[model samples]
Target: MLTAERDELMRIIRQLSYEQREVTLASGRKSDFYFDGKQTTLHPRGALLVGKAFYAALRQFPAPVQGVGGLTLGADPIATATALVSALEGQPLPAFIIRKEPKGHGTGQWLEGRKNVPPGSRVVIVEDVVTTGGSSMKAIERAREEGLEVLGVITLVDRQEGGAEFFAANDMPFVAIFTKAEVVG
Candidate 1:
């Protein structure tokens, strides 16, 4: 269900984050257009839209979605937004963060918020943008290592590159709200 807020968020994301320039991406590829989802997902309006949209997307998952999260930095804000929105919706989905590496001190955990997201819980991984799907895959690996079942993956923007194919090949359900074409056109 695309609410009015979701539509407006898409428009704002294009206005704020979509850029056209020759630049190397995290995937080590040059692209004509880039989507900096953090710019939009971090905004108040954008955050609300992302939460609402991602929450809705989670409902379509084949299995129950107990929580949501992804790799740190990019997925951090997104997971928070979705969890907040889920709370507003009265379901209250917990948000978890996957560290790139285990913390060096203390418990040296690779995942934070484990108190809420127990093992065996089903979770959905999120990303601000997907290029080669490397980051999201890493998050999935971390989550599985923690004994979490990844229900699916949802991204804000899909570069329309190899991400979809990668997820498909891995047999993981994937969804993206917008594509580079939709944002740049």
Candidate 2:
């Protein structure tokens, strides 16, 4: 369900992230319209709205989610904001980050914040946007490798591309706050 917060986030996203022009996406797909979710995810009010929406999603999840995380860079702010919101909501969920590559030094783990969450703890993967679903899939795989059980995937926006199909084929529960049509059309 899109609540008031979710609706406001959509408005902000449309105003900040939506663009029309020929451009290539991270998935290497060319499109006339693009959504750079970071523009909104990184904004002050945008982050707050995203946090509330994600936290609400977590609370409504069928199973308990011990942590929230996704591929770094894009997912970092989303996961962090959600965790902060959860804390404000009094549940205080821990947020983790899944690095694209292991850190260059130290433990060199591909995942972070695991120390705060126990092994085998259930977690939900969050993403700024979904196109081919590759990024979200990578995050889920990494989380599992780190001994975290993935409960589902949540994205700030879905391009209405093959992402949804990919997640469905892989049987990964997926949710998007807004679709391409909603933002672009």
Candidate 3:
């Protein structure tokens, strides 16, 4: 039987996926299909469902995770809601942000909100969508450079455009809540 949360998640995704004539992708490729993860992830119901789904998905990890985070912009809300609700649920996983570029002033750090994390903290990188795996891979690189152990990657949508294969080829465990076919078809 589907849990209440899982059922809600399916409803949110179905509601978010809509037909469009032309859509622009982050990779600058033109296509007749598009997925605006923000349309769901940013909504009240969507945020809760996504956070619960991610928490459930990552709970299978072999190691204890210090936190969850992802690249800026796309990953911002996902990480935020996950961290917040996870705490309320008493798991209390902190969230971090990986900047696309180092801040020009002040701390000038590339990764933020992880000051208390010691070296080699186990972390799971989160993403709203994984198309070619480029952005998620960059986030993984940045997390590694910060001395964090990457546990895996959790994406809301897998565009199935070679992203899952890319992660598997690199020996990285990648999980997604929805596939491109589920969204587009």
Best by lDDT: 1
TM-score of each: 0.95, 0.94, 0.91
Residue 33 displacement (Å), model 1: 2.2
- Best-first order by TM-score: 1, 2, 3
Candidate 3 total steric clashes: 0
Instruction: After superposing candidate 1 on the true structure, give the runs of residues whose Cα lies further than 4 Å from its correct spot.
Output: none
TM-score of 3: 0.91
CA lDDT scores, all candidates in order: 0.91, 0.88, 0.84
Cα RMSD of all models vs. native, in order, equals 1.2, 1.5, 1.9
Residue-level lDDT of model 1, residues 1-185, one tens digit each, is 46677679889898888888888988788888778888998888899898888988897797578989999989999999999988998999999999999999998999999999999999999999999999899999999999999988999999889999999999999999888777775
What tens-digit string does per-residue lDDT give for candidate 2 at 1-185? 25676778888999999888899888788899878889999999999999988887776567678899899999999999999988987898899999999999998888888787778899999998899999899888888888888988998898888999999999999988778888766
Stretches of candidate 2 exceeding 4 Å from the true structure? none
In model 1, the worst 10-residue window by lDDT is: 1-10
Candidate order by lDDT, decreasing, is 1, 2, 3
Supply candidate 3's per-residue lDDT for 126. Answer: 94
**Residue 87 of model 2, lDDT score:** 90
Best candidate per TM-score, number? 1
Report RMSD for candidate 3: 1.9
